[model samples]
Target chain A: MNAIIQTNELTKTVKGKTIVKNVNLIVKKGEIYGLLGPNGAGKTTIMKMLTGLIIPTSGEIMLFGKKLAETSKEGLKRVGSIIEYPIFYDHLTAMENLRIHCEYLGFYDKRAMIQALDMVQLKGIGDKKVKDFSLGMKQRLGIARAAITKPELIVLDEPTNGLDPIGIKDMRDLIRTLNKEYGITFLLSSHILGEIEQVADRIGVIRNGQLADEVSLSDIRRQRTDYIELLTSNVQRSAFLLEHELQVSNLKIVKDNRIRIYDAGISAGQISKLLISQDIEIEEIQKHTSTLEDYFYHQIQGGDKVD
Target chain B: MIKLIELEWRKLDRKKVFGEVIIYWVILMFLPVFFLKVVFADNPAVHFGESYGAAIDLMLPIQMGFLLFGASLINHVFIEEYKNKTMALSFGYPLSRKRLVMVKVLFIALAVFFCSLISFVLAGITTYGLDQALEVIDGSPSAADLMTYVVRMIIHSFATALASLIPLFLFGIWKRAVIPTVVCAIFLMQFPNFLGLLRITLNPDLFYAILSFLGVASVYLSVKLVNRLGDL
Candidate 1:
């Protein structure tokens, strides 16, 4: 795969505090790559640096196989982005706002304005002021603006924010269509792991301003294993008994009354019997699988200690 | 540069800025004409001179205030996008910052010029009516004097408009509209009296000349400030 965006030892600092530090990232063309992290994890900062909204403290960015600063106009011409909330002139109509954006791009296609509105399903809101739009509609309009020019690379920060379930689904579908239909590359930063999981071909997990891991969706799915969840009134007792008596070291207490066993060698039937014999009442026992959310939390928590 | 100007014009036009501006011009023009006819009817010569002076004097305040307003409007050329986090959308275009700023400034300058021209025309009509009324009652003033008065008023008003560019550029580059607006209001409101007092103590001609030089120098400094803002 051809790399569309690459960063080497990229860093940022604000007011004597490091926001992003020594981060390395790569995004290939025609792929929806997710940048997953919690709030204030420097996702927006990194996006700002890449888009040249903010100067980086150190390191470099390469876009379309050329240095980003070598020809900012050319590099940026291929990129479109929404770094945070969608903002527009409140008094202007949605179409008027998009028209302004088209003008800035020097794109004179008369049909593009309406076509963009159609893509976001906002075609009918003619002459209605943007201040009257709901948050979801505004978000959709933001996406429409970014995609209006049919840019080669689109960067969306928290694109699904303030969106309803249907809106999110529509946005995801639109993103997929853009990627598949036009071969456009996407760099998406989202805290909604499910949305990212549904759309991202690959994921880069950032924690505390550092890239923790980068893995393909297929690889993550293949490597992720299932575990047995056992919910009992006496979790501590069960964990102690399972570990000391049953010699099971892979048992983990997930909650006050829940323990998860990752060892495949231990049978639910044997664990149930052993718990019963130990006078512990097992309320629920079921197999649980790791998901994107699970993987995210695990990686973040695990990386915290090392940093 | 043309493309950027065209884009800003479209955006401003769509938002009814042009309509608002036209309304402002009409008011600036007609209000003086109406007020002069009513207030200065008794003494026609003083009427014509004061009317012309009022036309020029009115612009000093209006031009300064408009500079502040214009700054607020033009600062949005960048600040609004920054607030929206849409700077990337703009910077991602083929246009350079220099071109973008130049186009925006040109558009604003033209708008200011149009407003001033409309006001001047209205003042001219008022003077013509005053001249005819004076001719009917007393002896008519010579065409030469009328021409001179009109020409001087236009020149002074134009100079005031040009001087306002300093404050406009400063406020725009500062990106905080309120700060420059307040400072400009205070300075324009008080600086004349302050300078008058200084002239009484010193050589009045030299003092006025120095003030004029400072005004021009301030405008040049404003352009430099605007150029430096590109780095920001």
Candidate 2:
């Protein structure tokens, strides 16, 4: 599988302050890739660079195996995007906005325009002026415009923004349907974890404008850590007995009196037997599995390499 | 390039722009006749000379009115797009910023040029028609008068186009200030009047040449440094 988009040591600086720095990224063809970060974490900045909205101060962008730069914009014709927010000619109707967008791309498809609007559930409102549109409608219209041409790749920055819960779900389903049915690739950016979690095939965590890690959902699931939690009144003695007697070193003390054993190589029953042999009272003992959210938290907190 | 400019036209408020152009034509079309027949009827030979050719010279100054329209276009094409962030959408297209800026400048230039030419024709007809009724001048317009009108029409059309682009670099792209852009156009249109008010004796042709150069420089800088100026 070829990578649809790749950035090598990409850096963007504005007015002597680095906004995004030394970032490397890969978005494979026919996959839904999500950029997960907190607000003001440079997610939009990186998206802007990818979509050629702003020039990168350093490094390079390669789209479809070709260099993307001032002289090399041919690849962008096959790319579609909405960065920051949906902008439109407020006085123009939805159909007019989409028509102008298509004309710029040298594309003309009235039926496809209608279909795209229909796909986003904005079918009957094509004749309505954009000035009267609600925020969610504008977002949906933005998606309709981005997907209207059926470009090879679409980059959406916070596509679910300003949307109701139902609208967010519809957006997620639309992304999935486009990816699965039309085989379109996506590069989505959002601060909402659950929103990305539901749609992204692969996740890239960003922290402080750096690519913290990138992992496929399957990879994370395969490496899911299941730990046994032991809560006791006397954690000091309980930890001592587990370490000295049971030899449990793959464990973390989460709270004052709780020990989480990550090394599942030893059965929970064996640990219980050894801890019970000691005189420490076992207040609670339960098995806990590390979720994707936990793995993401660990990756960000630990600053681990992207798997 | 034509396609890109057409796309730019589709992006604007066409009704408002059309309304503005109509208003400019109606007002400028009658301005020269009003000044020649009504205001200076008593001293027509002194101010407007013997032939209606002098009425055309007044049309030249009145044609500078389109500079304001050019500034308004700068507001619509450059400043409004930036304020609305639709410019970012254009940047994302498979077109370079230099090309995009070029298209925008040329669009405004062409619009101003076309409107100025139309204004020239309207002012000429209005002045010629009104001169018959009012008898403001002593003699009929000669072949030389018609020739001068034709030559000035082309030159002033080009002048209007260039003058419209004068605010592109400074006020349109850099500061993105709407009022400053309009003020710049007003200053360019009234430059000769300002010099006259001060009793300055410089040649009007020399002043127009200087202003034309300024307009060219503004356009050059706008295209050359578009990468820096077009940044959000």
Candidate 3:
């Protein structure tokens, strides 16, 4: 029960083209798991498969400790999702749309409907048609609909898509509140690394239809490194001076001109002063911190095939 | 299953659907009288005005207009949902895709069948009232004629409901094209008239039976292949 969603070798192929390849993903209960990748990285496809919106070509999806298949979709009753984007009958009122969704889930609590609307700050607009709402309101209404049934798992794809900065922050806060106060597990997909970094407990980097890596934000934070990088014409002199004069043993000279110093005790000013005292020409120097953005970029564009 | 079918209606734009149905009803209600009092008034060869029993023949084909309504419902229930990506929302529900598709197919069938049936009753009353005023037909409807009209009304409406779904599997579900679906419904609604113009002699019951068979086949194929084709 700890893992609300477990997929084994989950693959999806459309017209002989593999969209998602052998994705073994596990989303634990009560954790906000973010799927991070560039556009066309199969993040939506994986979310679609996980939510039973689309069937995987070859894989096993274990949801809520039961096998998820076409016949055995009882797992979906406890799941709510917004795949790709929030879709509604635009001609219908927001309350009407939510009512239909609840009816489909066999949920018929009017108070819960009102509570979900109020929870998303969408109160007093339930009678308004979705077509009249702005994109931000629609996104919030989508979350309200998804969270209406108080499902155990809520999967949202790009929940902050097409929102203003304030709307995005509100969405992030609403997601956190739903996850923490309601004890709901979240599986969200976003191309925005900072958004994921802010909300997700763990992040899964998807590249070229495959999960390149899955790591916790805390682990990534722990692995975060700070180093001083310098651009100098004489790379050999900078390296020798830093090693002998400053005892900067952990260092690397990259691209024939840039030296990176990983010595925690030595500052950029100290390295620059040491190099200047040695009469070595110092072009430029700055302290650098490796962040999740760099980690995501490396996973996306660094090693794997990026088709 | 019934609840699922009802949900299909609840999910639709009720006002729009009602507007469409009213338009169909208003036009169809007076169409038979229009044909007798205007369209075929001078055409002595068209003996549909000769008797109530013969008039039933004209009414049967005229009410096939509901076949187009079936097409319209398919557009709303299936095609529009697919286009708007709302069908993906239904797919995410706990129900199987096949079951969901089955509900939609049944909803369309029931809507078309009842709408066509009510249309028959309305057209019957309108044409009769108009006939009372204008004496467009030769005599009043006999009990036999009334019974025959009622019987054919039930059977033909059922047939039209099924025939309307003929385009569902290929046009609605598979291709998801709007124009083609409506065009297919138009062709189906006018099929008998085309056969008449071509001087093709076919049994009416046999023809409806064939159309009903095709409609059932379409529903079967839609339910069977929905899981494969229902991906958004």
lDDT of each: 0.70, 0.87, 0.91
Estimate, for each residue in A20-93, the C-alpha lDDT of model 2 and write its tens digit: 88899999999999998888889999999988898999989999999999867889889888888899989999
**With candidate 1 superimposed using the best TM-score fit, by how many Å does residue B90's alpha carbon deviate from the native?**
3.4
Q: Give the candidate number with the greatest lDDT.
A: 3
RMSD of 1: 5.6
Residue by residue across B48-166, what tens digits does model 2's lDDT show?
Answer: 74667666667788889999999999999999999888888888888888899999998999999998899889878887787788776658888998998989898988877897888
Write model 3 residue lDDT over A57-88, tens digit each, in one string: 99899998899988988999999888777899
Candidate 3 wrongly placed segments (more than 4 Å): A231-258, A270-281, A302-307, B230-232
lDDT of candidate 3 vs native?
A: 0.91
lDDT of 1 by residue, A21-134 (tens): 999999998999999999988898898778766667788998898777523656877887887777776668888887787766667675887888889999889468898999
Worst 10 residues of 3 chain A by lDDT: A298-307
Query: What DockQ results do all the predictions give, each relative to the true complex?
Result: 0.37, 0.66, 0.75
Give the top-scoring candidate (DockQ).
Answer: 3
The top-ranked prediction according to TM-score is 3
The candidate with the higher DockQ, 1 or 2, is 2
Q: What docking class should model 2 receive?
A: medium
Tell me the docking grade of candidate 1: acceptable
Q: List the residue pairs that clash in candidate 2.
A: none
Each candidate structure's TM-score, on Cα atoms with residue i matched to residue i, is 0.78, 0.91, 0.93
